[model samples]
Target: MTELLGIPPQLLFGQLLLGLINGSFYAVLSLGLAVIFGMLNVINFAHGALYMTGAFVAWLLLSYLGIPYWAALVLAPLVVGLLGILLERTMLSRLYKLDHLYGLLLTFGLALIIEGLFRNAYGVSGQPYPIPSWLQGGFNLGFMFLPVYRGWVVLASIVICFGTWFLIERTRLGSYLRAAVENPQLVRAFGINVPLMMTLTYGGAVALAGFAGVLAAPIYQVNPLMGQQMIIVVFAIVVIGGLGSIMGSIVTGLGVGVIEGLAKTFYPEGSATVVFVLMAIVLLLRPHGLFGRTRT
Candidate 1:
């Protein structure tokens, strides 16, 4: 077998592909986190739970409503996102002027409650989500086989990430959002609905998490703890990429995924700790993150 750097191409490329797929998830999830924290200054510990909710919602829609994967893809996010808007309107909105710690605590408690409820009902076991009929196949790449679904994840991640970046950084609404973040009063003086925008911003951010959850349903077992496991790594990605940086989250996510994937092949034992280790190093070296802007 042909080898690159003394490793078989199959092993190397296979992990790379897997890494990229994971990166897509990271990008999608972290984008939401970045937006929420950056815009609202609230630490949403419930983000992972929202992501888990998205997966379960998709599963429910399919199982109960006979909704197909494609339809569920659109509906799950919309459903969860609506709930998130409600959450913001009723609960989260009250805490904007208070300390970030309060928001974190509230969300942390919410996460525990949400996860506990699901566990109580569904038990701890993982449920399988079948691949969509159209996405069930593989591509023969000669060096390594590529799953059609996995490839779709990569493409979807890129489009979604880029779209998010454009929405936040380039578009007119994004400008208002950024402006609102910097000076909500000023934006409000301009006749823009800052409060409503904040509410919608949070909803949109949560929707992003739901979208990622649907994408991941077929790949991993749908379980309550899935978000519990992923949330820590994602937080690390957010910190490593720098808070309030959209592109940073996207790029850093993909980079972390590839690095972790390669680490699995090269150093199986350290693969688990590599991201945290990198986090520590980045924290020591660049406190603001690689692409993060320093808070004034």
Candidate 2:
């Protein structure tokens, strides 16, 4: 077996693949966070809880309603998105006029409530979600074996990320969204329903979180605390990429994932702390984040 830097090529490639898979999740989750913060200006602390809800919804559909994984992919997000709309209309909208910290605190409280309810309903143990028959195998690719489901995740994440970027950066609707974010009063004067747009944007952002959760259900055990474990790392990704910067979130997420993977291979002791260390370094050197623009 060929060796690179004294590490077996297979082992190296395997870790890279794992890192890419993790990056996919990070990109999707962070993209959602960026969208919400960019337009709504509200830091959604409950995002991880919503993500956990998405996976649980998928699990419920499969276990109770006899829904297949394929169908749940389409349905779960919609269900969660609707829930998000309700939360926004009833709860989040009330916080817009207050300080950003108020919004954060409210969402954090909501997260605690949601997580607590789910924890009470379902024990802490992770429940297995069987992979669909069509995606139950792997292919050998010269250097490493690639699982079909994992490959699907990477492809789907890339497609979704680019598609979102295009919608926000290219389309007329996107232009309106950006305009409203800049000056809601002006956009409203032009007869656009700014409030509705905010609601929809928030819902869409949460839906993205739900979609990521569905994707994760098959990979990670469906457990109440799953989102809690990932949310902090994702927040770090957002900070490193620049808060509210869509492109920054996607690129930083993938790059950091690969870096973390490499760290695991070269220095196991630092692997877990690498992302935080990177976060600290980025804060010290470029507080606005790599892609964030400094406001004069």
State every prediction's TM-score relative to the real structure: 0.97, 0.97
Tens-place lDDT per residue, model 1, 1-296, is 33546788889899888888988899899989999999999889999999999999999888888898999889999988998999999999999999999999999998999899999989889888899989989999898999999999899989999998998889999999999988888999999999999999999999999999999999999999999999999999999999878998999999999999999888889988888998999999999887898876
lDDT of 2 by residue, 1-296 (tens): 33637899888888888889999999999999999988888999899999999999999999999999999988998988999999999999998878889999999999999999999999899988889999989999987999999999999889999899999989999999999988899999999999899999999999988999999999999999998999999999999999899999999989888888888788979978899999999999999899886632
Model 2 has an lDDT value of: 0.91
- Which residue pairs show collisions in model 2? none
- List candidate 2 stretches off by more than 4 Å: 1-4
Q: Per-prediction count of colliding residue pairs?
A: 0, 0
lDDT value for candidate 1?
0.92
lDDT scores for all predictions? 0.92, 0.91
Error of 1 at 215 (Å): 0.4
